[model samples]
Target chain A: MLSPAYLAVAAALLLALGPALPAFAGRPIIAGKPAPSEAAATARWLTAQNTWGFLSTISSDLSGAPFGNVVSYSDGVPGESHGIPYFYLTTLDPTARDALEDQRTSFTLSEFPLGTCGKIDPENPTCAKLTLTGKLKLVDLQSSEADLAKSALFTKHPEMKDWPKNHHFQILKLEIENIFLIDWFGGPKPISPTEYLEYGKNQALLKLS
Target chain B: MLSPAYLAVAAALLLALGPALPAFAGRPIIAGKPAPSEAAATARWLTAQNTWGFLSTISSDLSGAPFGNVVSYSDGVPGESHGIPYFYLTTLDPTARDALEDQRTSFTLSEFPLGTCGKIDPENPTCAKLTLTGKLKLVDLQSSEADLAKSALFTKHPEMKDWPKNHHFQILKLEIENIFLIDWFGGPKPISPTEYLEYGKNQALLKLS
Candidate 1:
């Protein structure tokens, strides 16, 4: 019942798929099906990779409201299972000092071109490349077994030998509360919170796996 | 003659090298006896991967300077050398549309965290992050060839299918002039007009790879 022209067009469309898909086209394979509580899986994936990430500290003074600096980061292994992307960092850096003075800060990581290449509207909450907001808490160093864990930290980055060592850098850890994770492609499902945590034993969410 | 205590201490220190260094440090490994050109090498390496960096476009009309947003990007490819990063973007978003009209636009691409992140201080060139004056251009979707090169743009983003499609994204690109890359930890080399085109061309600049 279809016209001859329609038949010809269908044939052409079929032929184009093979050459077009792989050559001048691109695709990323993401199995987006996550369990009900597997919210932090994406954060886990991001932390698992050796991606460049930053540790931001809120400046204490009102003059320095929300300033952040780039710093190397590591994932919180056990805490991640709880859905909070906790990072290991020191309070010695100015940014960290500022954050300690005021714990509010932005910790960001991005999977970029893939995110921006598409239509991104800043007004649209979903449009940001990488956005996270939370309070940065300085955790204890020697409170736990610092000796054994210290070796692990050094093993990962041997350059610390040259740095002027400090218990702040050597002791305190960082934890991100009320976190936000934005993955451009294959990111986790978006969840908009009506209100930030009112403060509790664990004020964080989206733990790294 | 040196004291016996000094000699013993030096011997013990030499033996401790194996356990002294921390594992997750940023100091680059200097394979040779001399510290290589750490600044230039670090700058080059940092500029290399920081392509998706944020381009902070500022604008003001009747009211005053509006808040800013970071634009995701990709610069020069690995094989065919180019100093300026190549960014593919579109005008569908209001920010880009508004940015197109503003001439005083500038960008700051935060390189992967330097233990101390460099921030932008436009007036002070000495500051690690400074105004790298550049211009923005819109794409002409008619050029199918260029569009083909960035075709994979959407394959990775299936959520994008929900948004309307426009061809202009295929044509637009950015050309940055008088730009300098900065690194706080790495010894930063001076950026010259010629070096922008000459040195960075061969390096695999963007994080795309």
Candidate 2:
């Protein structure tokens, strides 16, 4: 093993090289990815960590084909997740239009982009994947829930606030009814929506006990 | 600007710091991401570079709700792309089973994970997104197309070949009907399936001319 002084010198050298390399060169450390065994924790962790996922809806334009669109979403403000994904979407996009026509939808996220799945095939069970299926509902702008949703969305995606006003962006949330999480071998874990939503609360109670 | 000697020392330091850092520490340089103006090229590039994407299908298990699943897919062997995505799926998974019941499907990919988007938000049109609406069909194992697909899938995903034979993995191809590409602001670019598939050929002809 190298001495502490040697390691310090190496780290200093890396900082010196940082400006000349790519943006990811500094290699900022990411933390808080839950263990695979913590099924509810892992599922909620994925929602909080990822900024974007694929939202699928029944497409009216394609004569009932299932359409999946690349979209940005937020579970809540960073470090204070509530488990329900919220989106700022416009009907000018097909996904929002489809959701209005038919609310049945699913949102999918993968652990591959989180940089924690090191060298594993994305399809590998150990890499982790989540699919939440439910009805997509529009939030009433006047309601307190909408205020919370806007804060959750804007905090994660500052650019959304500056998007074209004429686009008629609306707030939408997934009324999650089914949760499918696969973080290890054997198959997808059986996780109810309530279990997923109340994971943090349950963990707090366990600590207090 | 720094002198050559100083830059060389910094590079040496980065190499030294590599092993102690995370998997993304080395920050492998990615290239060939086309500009937003090259809409067709950008769409094809997203398909060729990504190994997996979200495949959406109408779910029979969930009362016909649209379901999106994380899946591994390959368009072709590296550096020899055919622009038609092929998937290695097992009926044990709901995606394949749903495709059998209803062929209407769409596959979605985003350029955000390619690390070429820089600081741009994923929802920003400039970051690039592609959706291919199509029919999901299984390839007959006896056909020559299956040989090409297997070679393509194996070249990009070697672990796929080692998956258990008892899982009954089968090859499926998307029969693309429509293409939606968003690489710039304004709105989705209208790209026909024919235009997308023939882009490489058209590019070669233009180069020769």
Query: Which is the leading candidate under TM-score?
Result: 2
**Candidate 1 residue lDDT tens string, A1-209:** 44445534544564467543222122222333122223344444444342334444433432332233444444333332222333334443455566657655555554332233244332222333334445566545645534434443344334433443442364333343333444322333444332211212254433222
For candidate 1, write residues B182-205 as lDDT tens digits: 433332245653555465455543
Model 1 C-alpha lDDT versus the unseen true structure: 0.39
The runs of at least 3 residues in candidate 2 whose Cα sits more than 4 Å from the true structure, single-residue gaps closed, are A1-32, A202-209, B1-31, B202-209
lDDT of 2 by residue, B124-204 (tens): 776789999999999999999999999999999887886767778999999999898987656888888887888887454
- Listed in order, the DockQ scores are 0.09, 0.29
Question: Could you give the CAPRI-style class of model 1?
Answer: incorrect
Compose the digit string of candidate 2's lDDT tens values, residues A124-182: 67678999999999999999999999998999998787676767889999999999898
